[model samples]
Target: MIFVRLCLNTIVRRWNSTELTKVQMPAIMHLTRLGYTYAVKFHDNQAGEDYVPDTNILIKIFKEQFERLNPDKKDTFNQVLKDIKMELDNDDLGRSFYNRLVSVSPSRLIDFEHPNNNVFHCTAEFTCKRDEDEFRPDITLFVNGLPLTFIEVKKPNNNGGMLAESNRMNNQRFPNKKFRRFINITQLMIFSNNMEYDSEGGIIPIQGVFYCTGSKSKSSFNCFREENKGGEKVAPYNAEYSYKSIDSLVEKRVLTDFNC
Candidate 1:
């Protein structure tokens, strides 16, 4: 599978274009190329909750992976989802959730030992609502139906650009208590306007794409850089991966348009 961050570097090279073509759609397609399935938006309705982790998909995938990972404990399969849901819901700052995600302490939510044994999905326009407040991220990446990270793409050269999006997330989004669970569930948040980073020594991120873990802090936002074997800065590869009938899939599914 292609590394997601490395694929995200494609945005910088095409920053001057529209949001969908330049960053959002390409990001989704890249993930699909990297073995992530493109989950249709309507399926998000099956989430059946105002909040996230998409319980419908979560339970289904968990059941499958749990059986696969814990073959000897097949009879205990029914309890694992409940345990995971309880742990995820009660998590503080996603610390517990993160632990479960990377390790198998609470339960084997993911099969880190066998990469191909897991399910990877990328969905667009995932909605999360709590009370009167709501958040609809541009794209969300799911592993075994657990929403671990989400991406927000801004129009290139929009007013205030990536900086403005950053402020909105920090000042408006993060401050809302309703989204606390959303924040807890999402381990990473990425914002991009397709602009290149300021190598001219800007102390803070003023352009390009930036990311933060769980939640944001005053100076927590960071950008990605690729280095070669010799440790010299290099550009990201704008490569394509040909899956079976990918051209047909891309053409038929308007959502996966590869005009980029």
Candidate 2:
């Protein structure tokens, strides 16, 4: 009788410890600690409860980073916007993503149709192909004359491996669409989540998707190739990339490389 009781007690203790470990786990995995200096520097003191990033700030960052990268690409901005619209029109998911992406920018204040205006309006639910269902994306990014990039964001807490899932959705929605047209015009695709990074640099990959993160050090930016032939150090398709601080990206003018 005593032996049976001891066995039962051991089983109960192990189960209790497992429950405690789970209780202590964070609600969200892969939480990133924002650099304190960057937080302080970018702090907004405005009075409204609806604090958001100003469109001018985005424009400034793009101009500074993009121009520094591709000084020759200035005339193509309008064309880039058109390509974005074309892609979004072709896919329902793209349309939805575009709507959310715009909300984060201050340029949302500008009416989309004024000629020479710096902001463009987009439809969240629009019919593109004849006899096809209406489509939507999470957000659409537009400038005065062109659709720039389509941003798709997922909250990690709501979905496991949300970044990978979002990328899958992007492929399904925009497959066979000419990324080159947009890439030629805007320079890159930004696929980011609240916690991870997945991007396609302007170049085509012979292997996996090319990725980059915001970094203070230029040397820290590196690319990874995906392969079925595995090695111990090889990361799975959904593995997280260490992100460079957003502050470093802004300060370094990395986007300016596209403008050249």
Candidate 3:
């Protein structure tokens, strides 16, 4: 747990699945502490109180980040915001949104290692509501106040696998408008459970959906059972596939941003 804390200092505290917090999410309060957009959370003209980004703050982050990457493209600001809003409302998976942001210039939109050249913002357990279907997830990772990833945590190996559900929820929900607007700029949709040991026969994978904690994932054993092997057979964890998806998006973001 300490390793997790060291690796990811998310704004929210440790989450309890059984005891879901009906109260306000901690991220809403600590966005500034965790380095939110411009080191400031959103506020409105009517009332000067900390709140999530409204349309203006969202557009401001886009403008500031865009200017940082492509200073020559100020003419595209209004149209870009219009396009971004349309993309956010229309595209459920945020593929188009990701492309629009990174395709403008060749610069890092999110850099943890670079203090000055960073636009990425990460928060957890923030409330996102669309029409009718209001579901609160465990975590939401953001870049420049634009969400980039949605992570759902469950008990150790709560179900059989996550690849199926991740696909279903993220890819197939386009037909249902109610669920589409909740996620924005999402490059990765991760479903992970705690480390679960196979009581009958031990398996190498006993942790989250990702194999490694810091931007790497690999599995030693295969998921399938070999006839010759005496012990229970295991197929390769699906982490490789997930990693490839994330990597492809990142690569595209870079190439498009650089105009290469």
Task: Give each model a TM-score.
Answer: 0.75, 0.27, 0.48
Query: What would the per-residue lDDT of candidate 3 be over residues 3-86, giving only the tens digit for each residue?
Result: 888656442423332212321223222333344422222223422132223222245565677566556776776676566667
Model 2: per-residue Cα lDDT over 15-115, one tens digit each: 43442222111111111121111111112342122112221123333343334333576555445433444554433434432563344232232334443
Q: Pick out the ten consecutive residues of candidate 3 with the lowest summed lDDT.
A: 211-220
Model 3 TM-score on a 0 to 1 scale: 0.48
Model 2, position 251, has a per-residue lDDT of: 30
| Deviation (Å) of 259 in candidate 3 | 46
**Each candidate: what lDDT?**
0.67, 0.33, 0.45
lDDT of 2 at 192: 33
Score residue 58 of candidate 3 by CA lDDT: 46
Off by over 4 Å in 2: 1-134, 158-163, 166-171, 176-187, 196-260
RMSD of 1: 9.0
TM-score, candidate 1, is 0.75
